[model samples]
Target: MTAVKFLSDEYLDELGDLVTPDLPEVPHVNVRLQFHATDTPEGEVDYHLVAERGVVVRAGRGLLADSDLAIRASYRDLLAFESGELHAATAFVTGQFAVTGDRAKVLDLMVVLQSGNYQRFIADLWARTTW
Candidate 1:
């Protein structure tokens, strides 16, 4: 299968499909997370995920109205994280990833993000993404 450009319309469509099946059921992780990846070859890429009861109810380009968390980072850094070269927590700890939101919400969200299913989601994303 041919890979899609990162953050392309086709890629987002793929991500949207992955959400319902891939996301684990963890109600406490409910949150709207906005992701901003700046300085990409195609300029900036922005997206958001609205998860309720551990399932993503919405996924789309740009920001959501009331996100529980907003993560901003360089496209390179984000690519590294998604591609398995850098770990998400390591990126956050090293200041490569900037997040603004409730601390408790972050903890809750981490549960789902740290799950094995999430890892599978990342692997699937890596497979479909074009560097």
Candidate 2:
């Protein structure tokens, strides 16, 4: 998975494994990711995550029919966050990360983000990614 392109099909496909196990503590959270990167073929891509009973059963491209939250950000910023170079709070406060939709969902994501599991997952993903 080295030299991976940002938000490419392969990247998005692999996201499910990394993200699913990290949400074991929260089961009712669903979110949509709107990724925008300058070099992407379409300049943007979308993904949705649906976790139930602490497991992610569905995660793929496009928005869910009804989503709990929408987390949007540039490709670089997202990479930075996942790489631990950009703090989530700093990214949000600096406008690098924009979150919308249900507050409860956001809270659940926040919990995951605060946990070491998320950090480990991010690190693993970053390791697999080339840039």
Candidate 3:
């Protein structure tokens, strides 16, 4: 399996546009994604995503003191999920992905997976990489 590199800034910028329009009228939540690339020799990468008031900002870090939500999954799973090739719920059920934190907040974030917009985003990204 090839290791995938996800730049926190780029990911957040894309996610911001997709999420802002659908966000509820509530304070922002800080969600940290600790990605463990299983097939890679390099260690884990922490992607910190802060979503609040219709804005999402991502920062690459080694650790976070506070994380309302944490998602643990391989790069391939993330690619499959974002590209709509895999269902997030099904992945969770199958133990391909693990999520920890406030269940409600986690569920709220998961709602985006059902929107189908992420597929288009992933397609665009894949196209760019091919060139």
Top TM-score prediction, candidate number: 1
Candidate 3 C-alpha lDDT tens digits along 1-131:
22233434444344444443453533443344444434322344455545443234443444557776677887678667655688878887888877777656666556433435444655665554310
Worst 10 residues of 3 by lDDT: 1-10
The segments of candidate 2 whose C-alpha lies over 4 angstroms from its true place after superposition are 1-3, 19-42, 53-55
Show pairs that collide, candidate 1: none
Candidate 3 Cα errors over 4 Å, as ranges: 1-34, 59-62, 113-121
- After best superposition, candidate 2 residue 39: deviation in angstroms? 6.1
Candidate 2: tens digits of C-alpha lDDT, residues 1-131? 46555577777777766555544465554444333344355477787666554445566666666776777887778778767889878986787877777756665666556666556765777677765
* Decoy 3 TM-score against native: 0.59
Evaluation by lDDT, superior candidate among 1 and 3: 1
| TM-score for each predicted model, relative to the true structure | 0.87, 0.73, 0.59
Model 3 residue 123 lDDT score: 62
Error of 2 at 99 (Å): 2.2
lDDT of 1 at 5: 81
Please write out the lDDT profile of model 1 over residues 47-120, one tens digit for every residue. Answer: 88777777667786777878888889998898888788987778878889899986566666666566776678
Q: Check candidate 3 and list the clashing pairs.
A: 28-52
